[model samples]
Target chain A: MYSNDGFRELERHECLRLLAKVPVGRIVHTRQALPAVLPVNFSLDHDGAVLLRTSAASELVRAIDGSVVAFEADEVDALTHSGWSVVVTGSATVVTDPAEHERLTRTGPSSWVPSPQEVFVRVEPELVTGRELVGGRSLYGVDLTGAT
Target chain B: MYSNDGFRELERHECLRLLAKVPVGRIVHTRQALPAVLPVNFSLDHDGAVLLRTSAASELVRAIDGSVVAFEADEVDALTHSGWSVVVTGSATVVTDPAEHERLTRTGPSSWVPSPQEVFVRVEPELVTGRELVGGRSLYGVDLTGAT
Candidate 1:
């Protein structure tokens, strides 16, 4: 468990809270050393899982065919506003058990937009941490390190 | 060639411009299909190729060794409320020639503190595109689809 040494942990939780507000997130994965990032709509399942849906041809299905993956969600506020982000770096294996997958599938509606004939990606979050923007001060950033 | 759909073409140049302005860029690579993003500093050479130094000990050096990597650079503004982003998607191969590697090492100081030394990443712009935000109007997007 590598800790993000960039910012103090006080605002870590805020990052997750902000993530839940935004529906779009970047899913990062690798194929033969090349990093591929795709956008997906996600929701926090509260039962220690993050649920997401995607199409069969979408990149999500291609990458999650039984492999370790990292799911990231973030939001940034630029105005007299504040923002935070939470990234869940964990093993994203496809839900294989029909019952478990069905449970997650039933917890919420699928976010698949292009088609309803796509698979879903559920992240079993191993480590969850976040960062927040406080008081709407001139926004600053900590070096995005140890964030996964 | 897969065109970067969301990346506006004119903003592509702007994204490069910002890369020169800021030494660091967040590089996301996949390890066993998981997304691993790290903070790194890089420079643009005469041909707009991205040059960053690291060694075999560096995570980036290992990831980009022989893969199709996606590199992203973004600028978020809080002043006039505008920002731009650029993404370079291509294959990265190590510059093994002594002259080529040395010339890259001499370009400028690195963008990272407590640097990851000795290796280099050359991102040839196979696809470049960008987008900008302006005023209260719609998003300003340009597609430099066929720019070399």
Candidate 2:
């Protein structure tokens, strides 16, 4: 699907694939009844859930636990003005089960901040949407001639 | 001010300064009661409001008009693991006044999409907050030795 602005809409599978290619993303959630965004390093689970590791006592943990949030990741080329962006919207829940926590600790994304009390917050990809700006050409460099 | 996780807190002026350095940022807003994020090219007004150019008929214009939203911009170095991120929470309003629209059309950010009906959206910086991850050193490459 193509938007009126010429951006191509990506499929769910394509969105998830593009998301896994980037290590960092911005998390959007409500803070004090207003929206707030923070950038963090993240990873994708096999089931496509977003996994974030942060200090257990962090403000992010307090704000996003059990709340509907949005996770967005993108890669852009300034020279070509071409890029793709993916957003996943769902509930964010801090992992609390001992076994699950242990598994995530061993396999989840490494924290930028070295903290012993880091915990994993999982965001299910309940609504996945993405768009690609191709700059009048196809991904393979072929001119679309307004055919995209 | 510093957080328990070692990330340096940025003051309001510093946050605005960093925000002005980036050309692209994520806009976070509520869509159908769920948080949604989209990357947009923006410029800061003289009063620190974020100015965005988009099609008047775009979904973004519909979703964020007269609503509180978050605008976040950042620059990160993956190799050095250092970066600064700023988030501005404010009300987004579509510029509807003819004089203001005419002025913004002459002075505002250029549209990425070539559309004749593009309009400017202004986001007031009601609340600005930012954080800098310094990777155990000062921004000038000097060791802080835990003194920052």
Candidate 3:
């Protein structure tokens, strides 16, 4: 369904599919009772959970573990003014199991920053929603304008 | 200053400069007591406040007014593995003054999605922090891997 503002709602499967195509995303979590966002390189697990690798002692690990957070990924074409954005809201937890950690270390996303030790954080896809901005359709009888 | 992870901290003026170069950004806020993120076309005001124009009745408008929110923008190069990200955390307030609203209508960011009526949401840059990933340095003697 399309919203009154001209964005079409994307299905769950479509959302997950689009999410896996991107290599980087932003993670949103609360810091000191206020919202905070950080860009991170991420991958999608077999069950569509967002997997992130970061320094084990990083502040992100402390702020997001055992808390509800939002992850967003998108691809936009400035010329065509077309793109899709997917947001996954779910609980995040640090991967602590030895065997699971070993497996993830071998198969999960690699960190952009070089680190001596890294840990994986998993965000389950509990709530997924997305919107697509289609090109050339003027809804609400208002002219569509490009970002300024 | 460079962090242990190889990211260089950007100064406040540099953060605002980088923020103005981008046409789009993601806003992080709390929705129903859970963190949520949405991509929006935005612009910078004279004082570097993040300015967003959206439908007056949208969920984002209701979720962030008078609340602290985070706004993030970035530019990345996959081949060079270099990028800079700036995040602005501040209180958001809907512009209600008629004179200010009229001024913004002429000078503020134009919405990507067509809307009959729009309102401006301003985020004061209370805490601005940024990081730059410099290219081709084996910091800490570890190989930097590209996003996978």
Candidate 4:
């Protein structure tokens, strides 16, 4: 059901399920104190950690390892004007364990970009939130008196 | 010619032109000091400012006015494993001038989500950067020894 705001909050489980289905997402990290958004291809592990493959030489891999980052994915139909977005935030750490790294390298989600993606980083989500808009409608009916 | 990275840097004018063609993009803003990303329907004006329509009652509308934000859009072919992403960063300000507001409301990009989107915010891009991956390839040829 759509609320007055025309957005419905999705449950955490539902958000993860949606995240698993999508192959690409944008990763947000602060660069020089300004927020930078980079579209990345990622996969969800059974434990819900978001996995990414990047070149060890890439700025993203160097700048964000062991640092906090936000990953987001969404599916919106341009015609229906309806879609859902899921955001996951957590510290991203490199997969250093040899056995685990090998396992992931062999079977984890693959990267779409052609590069020497030797670095495998995992973000263990500390927070997950999602919202869905069911349709396009006139916002005129919603109260905006408190708008800033 | 493709570089060793297999990625090509896009010029600012080209990036803006591409951004103008997309009806949707993700906006990245800092909330409570943490980076947050939200997808928004947007249109680029002649001067290159990113325009958005949002309900006055929404947190994004209230929190981002006069704040710096990053907006990004891209197209990636799953089969070809190629895509380009453009990100624009600038200060977002709420339109306060009545005449300009009216003009924008009458002709600006329309939102797909039905809600009272009375607030019109614009981000005059201070910087724009983009990159394109030509195709999927093996990462083995790229040198990774210098990778961070």
Best by TM-score: 4
DockQ of every predicted complex: 0.17, 0.29, 0.32, 0.37
Chain A superposition TM-score, candidate 1? 0.73
Docking class of 1: incorrect
| lDDT (Cα, tens digit) per residue for candidate 3, span B43-141 | 898888999887787667777899988888887665566788888889999999999999998999876665777889999988888877776422211
Per-residue accuracy of model 1 over B1-148 as CA lDDT, tens digit each: 2234333335556667766775444456665545665444567777777666655455456666777666666554433334555666777777888898777667733533233346567877776655554423211112121122
What's the distance in Å from true for residue A55, model 1? Answer: 1.7
Candidate 2 clashing pairs, residues 3+ apart or interchain: none
From the highest TM-score down, the ranking of the candidates is 4, 3, 2, 1
Pairs that clash in candidate 4: A56-B147, A57-B147, A137-B114, A139-B115, A139-B116
Q: Is candidate 1 or candidate 4 better by DockQ?
A: 4
Would you list the C-alpha lDDT of every candidate in the order shown?
A: 0.54, 0.75, 0.75, 0.74
Clashing pairs in 3: none
Clashes of 2: 0
**DockQ-derived CAPRI band for the predicted complex in model 4:** acceptable
Cα lDDT tens digits for candidate 3, A3-28: 65556778889898989887877887
Per-residue error at A132 for model 2, in Å? 1.2
In candidate 2 chain A, what residue range of length 10 has the lowest lDDT sum? A138-147
List the candidates ranked by DockQ, beginning with the highest.
4, 3, 2, 1
- Give the alpha carbon lDDT tens digit for every residue of B1-148 in model 2: 7664446778889988988877778788776777777777888888889999877776678878999988888886755778887888889999999999999888888766556577789999887777787664222211111112
